[model samples]
Target chain A: MSAAERSLRGRAAIVGVAESSLGEVGPGISSLDLIGQATVRALADAGLSKSDVDGLFTHSAFFAQPVLTTAEYLGIRPRFADGTATGGSSFVGHLWHAAAAIEAGLCEVALIVYGSTQRSHGGGLVASGAALTRSWETPYAPRIPASAYALAAARHMREFGTTREQLAEVAVAARQWAKLNPAAFVQDDMTVDDVLSSRMVSSPLTVRDCCLVTDGGGAVIVTSAERARNLPRPPAYILGAGEATWHMNISQMPDLTTTAAQESGRRAYEIAGFGPQDIDVVELYDAFTINPILFLEDLGFCAKGEGGAFVSDGAIAPGGSLPVNTNGGGLSYCHPGMYGILLVIEAVRQLRGEAGDRQVARHSLALAHGNGGTLSSQVTAILGDESTL
Target chain B: MTDNVRADVESLSPETAPGTVFDRYAAEGVLAYQSCGDCRQAVFPPRVLCPSCGSDDLGWEPSAGRGTVYSATVIAPRGKEPYTVALIDLDEGFRMMSIVTAGDDGAVAIDDPVTVSFRLAGDEPPLPVFAVEADR
Candidate 1:
């Protein structure tokens, strides 16, 4: 094998990852309070206290809203705080930002947190929220994200031979994974027939194709390789990361069948110096079942139009060659509005050898990718074994 | 409202208060987009300021609303089923997502010819939609 054969395997590490309960924790808990609990748990998991955290990154629907005043309530003043709101994609973007900050020695440890009360707060569609309301989108029928995403799903069916069954396969696999996850919401070992028979939300995408609505919070702590040696568990090193945007609104996107994930995935692979073949596991944001089908092709796991087939034959299952969404995923796991953060936490646990039953075989490299705002944005993060660093 | 922005049935209006451009176009029966002077970019759902260059200098230019069907889906959810959403590429070089009023005849191909129309979603202002243009 030539020197070009392999790329740099490991670099940064995730020392701690935590989340509040997957189910509704009650309306008594505000989004900020959930953030506080998740953040504290993450710090404890890393064998550190809130005082040890100097960096904070958050993707909030309530960014400037009064509920985001967590720094004061937690009593920890982080020197770095990023409130980047790229829809659900913000979590993956935050992971990349934290990795860069730690690598630059700007912060010793970074805590990226996300919290939402979807059940009680009535988490509005990502597009209807304050974040996505630009001049053009608001005027056009409120740019319902479900309707917009429905539009994209329709296009995919028109262009390629992607079928409703293929879309159902994604939901089926997710629900199967959910069965193993004690925290999952819907776990009936669904079949394609069950998915097809389910009620429709926007067309093409049935209710089952869409993610769950739960009130919860998730957080993860990232640190440099040197700082991780003292942690309670081995860290999941940051191997590569990348992010990109296609268009502000669904209507303006150049191509809906494909996502910005192609460019983002390519850039991430280049930075990590690894290709798709080297990845042992994947955690893609499945806000809609169609998302995984589109992303698998864009991420270069399979050829275009083959996503329908790629999802079939149990290829993405736990024992499959590529185990995706091992923690039940947004489709099964808790999708408290921003489901991307949960993907990162799950990957960190898998890499740290913490997943007792859902763990894949000797997983050394993993990829976490997410989509934001009707597939308007995308971010990819790669993790590896600590020893590779 | 450009003349082409009118509803296909000659009935519904997409907006409650149609903008000056849309009103004028509705009267004239023409389709057009806003062109920004700063970046020379074409903006759909026309805007006063250029999103690319932030230039306030803008002008209305005629649009063919003729392009290919980039991608489409037929959503059959419980309440809403059997409706199509297509991404249309305009002759002026911009893409937009809208409901396809007609069936997916061969006319809805990748590079099909579509003429712009206004869609009335309930009572809100009519929205810009596209259909297979008839032969001239």
Candidate 2:
């Protein structure tokens, strides 16, 4: 079923997008401080005040009662609050929830926020005590997040003959994009050999194949499309949004080679009345190198098992047919634990024609997809210029 | 059940969680999984309700302890002994993730036939593992 009949379609628009100073923010700074800084900057960018926000949406793997904490810290009692913690894609999911809230007259403006001090606090990717899977799966081997993705990568290579070079191309392309983004954590030039030769975290996944860990935070303001016209920047109209969760643990995944993006993307496209060929820019979560490849295939950008060849020869580079992750990605951009929020922020910037160096020729329609857990949860947000609304 | 194979298995204690029945069976050197009483369908990592039929009437049943390797990865950290982790599709119908001991060579591949084994670490009960079938 599609959201064609739902009023939420084309009803909400992103009015503001901003990020805290990327890269190292030092040890004294906490995630709460980052959230406050980004929230103020984003609200200012939207030409809205903290009092204008009646809805709040945020998630934290490290902090408990995050939505309440943000509300109390920001000192704005929100009528609507959502702390839907589904890993990195929580922010993308929040967009859909906020849109529904606005359409139902529950709230006028919503603030979606995320922050992490993983680098400054020496926090690892998987929160130290967060038990993701069953106890049975943990004793035999360490259950680090990369090892989980490594299992899927191994299965995909065995089933489809995907080579290491193809996976390395993802890292290389991300670096090329990062070179243009001043806020990117690592903009150094890299080659396929550099990725292939990096220290192996898991079989078939090198350190380069993994995303960088840094302290960063980002926020976006969403409100009714009618109110967005009076805002400071061009509003990125929300054409369609979809989210799904097939499994929580990698072991329980029905198919290792495919992710839930198939269902989420299909729903989003059906609602938007558009297809893969129509997307002008794409920002997909790249927590691992294998993620974008799987998302490309599962989202119907390419045929099944053909993602290896689809991404070769700079297909996703800045001047390519489909520009993906224009502000770099989790692979090169800042990955403050959950990288989903950053994806939507970049999509909004691209759709608004604000992406300075890595802007695509046609910036009307953009698709931002986020993968949470071990490719277990998938969320797709289709943003477009106000003209499309 | 193989009672004489105590030393060959890991001696870790069963986790005191909702699904310790699976661990109880593992500690006894018998591989068992939960089966719904209504649908007779197998469920792994034991849950209170059957995912397919939504029946809470579940019972434990012994498995043949054999399956194929759905996927495998060698996690070789620096200065550490490398071990192979795999997702084994059990013969009874459920899939599980566990470490694989492919003899001294530690050689394993996808779709290889495997048999269930057990290993102990610290004070925890024996955890189920997989080993490639010798003839395969």
Candidate 3:
């Protein structure tokens, strides 16, 4: 496709990706400290220096103007800048926006970064709830995203015959993946029973079903496809990406069991000229156990009501037919407020065969999906190594 | 953008905006939603412009006070009384988030028919909650 066209597959590539100190960094660490650390390492991994950067994309709870703050911190003036913050999926949306900028020759060496210290600062639960825009539901003290998500989960279960065991399977699989990843927040063995028996925070979802509150930051470096090919690390080519949102409030969503991932995934796949079966590995923003199931169905991996069954029998776990969230995902991995950046980092690692023990055998095309708000913003990206390109 | 940000960016005057007008209706012990004059679409959490039609000519309409529970959940915070929160679809063709005052905790479920119940406490602003009514 032409640069002027909407499609941007293989027009830009992710040259480097890295993460800062994960799990917990203590009270002394700030969100910018992690962002700076990750930026330095990520630029180095891309075989590029600070002077080479011209485009900057970032999202954070720490800055009202994320790009401007990050640019001043890195001491560089970017020709292009964006600070679009739509919650957790903000970073993933950055990837799509970055590629478009590159293809349009707006700038070169785009940096997409994110950082958070919610766990270290404490009040992760309270802060998460407060972050959600409240109104009619505020008086009732619904646990913000968790309670909102539980409402959707309950409806899905009632409509599709999905059981708590099916939901627990997602957490168990994430824990299994966590055991192989040292950077994971929790690496202990977990089972369906364990997840089911864990403390219930919101009905239809237990504490175990929720994502962890941990401190971490991650960054990705993007450049033109030609430049990325000459970088030190194997380029994770941007095959296709798409973003869509239908509602901000959980109650406003048209359907409880469905999400906007359906539209986002379809747009991404159409742009990439490929479907889910072509993807080798999958990385989904699993903020809650029900997230993967909902995304799986909406992303066309399975029929709408079949997500519960598709995830059962170790489907997305390490010894399974399909590899997912090899870096442990938000469920067992570190979730530093916004998790979209980590999703991109994990996909790039898998595509480049840098995932170590958790690496999938056929590491070519990978799909990363990010969810923000109460399943509000959905951004899907399809990335691949040079082979697929 | 988050809805909060959108609300702020497109904020209306206090006499017409979501927060104030809705508060005024609550103070008078009634539930109201915005009805677009152009599209006739029912808008909850009122907006200056009709989200469906981009029409600025919007007016308020009182709800018939009955709805169906589209979804429900119980937030069981530690050492606190669990309460039911639900997404209710009003018969007037709009949906809203509300508290479900059921006979038992976690008793409300999807598809349950409910009616509006007022919680008009002293000093605090009156708000609407749903009562899971027994089948008659």
Candidate 3 clash pair list: none
How would you encode candidate 2's per-residue C-alpha lDDT over A101-139 as one tens digit per residue? 898889999999988888888757637245666565677
Per-prediction TM-score to the true structure, in the order listed: 0.85, 0.95, 0.94
Estimate candidate 2's alpha-carbon lDDT, on a 0 to 1 scale: 0.86
How does chain B score by TM in each prediction?
A: 0.65, 0.81, 0.82
Query: Residue A145 deviation, candidate 3, in Å?
Result: 1.4
The sequence of per-residue lDDT tens digits that candidate 3 reaches over residues A282-336 is 9999999999999999999999999999999999999997887888999998888
Better of 1 and 3 by DockQ: 3
Q: What is the per-residue lDDT of model 1 for residues B18-108, given as tens digits with 9 covering 90 to 100?
A: 2555546634546667776668798776655666887666666777667766665555544543555667778787777665656445324
Go through the candidates in order and give each one's C-alpha lDDT. 0.75, 0.86, 0.86
Candidate RMSDs in Å, in order, are: 6.1, 4.2, 3.9
Segments in model 2 whose C-alpha atoms lie over 4 Å from true places? A2-5, A126-134, B1-18, B103-105
Better of 1 and 2 by TM-score: 2
Candidate 3 segments exceeding 4 Å error: A1-3, A123-134, B1-13, B104-106
Tens digits of lDDT, candidate 1, A1-389: 22221232354678888997666777678878888889888888989988888887887765563224767767767787777778888888988777767766688788888888777766553322554433444443422566677677777877787899988888888887788777777777788898899887766777888888888788888888777877887888877777899787787777778899999898888877788888888899998888998899999999987888899877787677678898888888778888888998888877877787788886788899988887988999888885545
Q: Which candidate order results from sorting by DockQ in descending order?
A: 3, 2, 1
How do the residues B26-88 of candidate 2 rate in per-residue lDDT, one tens digit apiece? 788878887777898888877767878987666677889999999887888779888888898
